[model samples]
Every structure is written in structure tokens, then in C-alpha cells.
Target: MLSLTRRIREEILVIDRQTGEQIVIAPTAYRGNQVKIGIEASDRFKILRRELQGRERGPGPG
Candidate 1:
């Protein structure tokens, strides 16, 4: 499983290790603390967060 951040609206997504499919979970902004996980076909899904990338965090302030 891969953890990726949604680009446009700050949503969360995951990819199934067995299947080569993408699951567009509920947006983190709206869900707040809720999370959803499931599997579905690619044709039945729409990607609100098109671009996804990762970045490292800087050192915390003292």
C-alpha cells in the first residue's frame, strides 16, 4: 500500500498492492478525522486530485 496526498483539495488516496487500481478516498479537509477504504474499478472512479507528490518536512523549531 502506498500513501499519497491529494493535490487539489488535500485529500488522501491509496493503491491496492494486489490490484493496479486507484482509490480516491474522502477528502481530508471535509472528512476531518474520518477515513474510508474500499476497492472499485477505475472506470467507476473520478480523480478530483489529479496530481500527487511528496515532500520532506524541515526540522522543528526549538
Candidate 2:
């Protein structure tokens, strides 16, 4: 894992060289020890929390 320090509104981007797709993340808010982040990515990407990665998926309410 790579770690870097970023101030609020400063962005870090990750790109896929093969597909030319990218994700931009930034720190939007911070209070005490908690932080709120903002991410910008295309619809082709699926983003989820680390804790929910292994959970099974089911249909949502209709």
C-alpha cells in the first residue's frame, strides 16, 4: 500500500494504463479523528467499502 499526505481539496488519482480509466479521490472534510472523502469515477467502476467486499449480493427492494 502507498501512503501520502494530502490537504483538504487536494486530489490523488489512480489510472488504469490499459483502459485509460481513472479515479480521483480527495479529502473533503475532517473533524477530530474522522475524515470525509470524495471520489470521482466513471459508471464503469464499482466502488464499495472494504468490509463489504466479501458479502454476497442480493436483489434490492422493488
Can you write out model 2's per-residue Cα lDDT over 12-56, one digit (the tens) per residue? 999999998889999999999999999999999989999999999
- Give the number of colliding residue pairs in candidate 2: 0
- On a 0 to 1 TM-score scale, where does candidate 2 land against the true structure? 0.85
Best by lDDT: 2
In order of appearance, the predictions have TM-scores of 0.28, 0.85
Deviation (Å) of 38 in candidate 2: 0.6
Model 1: per-residue lDDT, tens digit, 1-62?
Answer: 56665433454546778885666554433255655433334765543433443444579999
lDDT of 2 at 27: 99
Q: For model 2, which pairs clash?
A: none
| Number of backbone collisions per candidate | 0, 0
Q: Could you give me the TM-score of model 1 versus the true structure?
A: 0.28
Candidate 1 Cα errors over 4 Å, as ranges:
1-8, 26-62
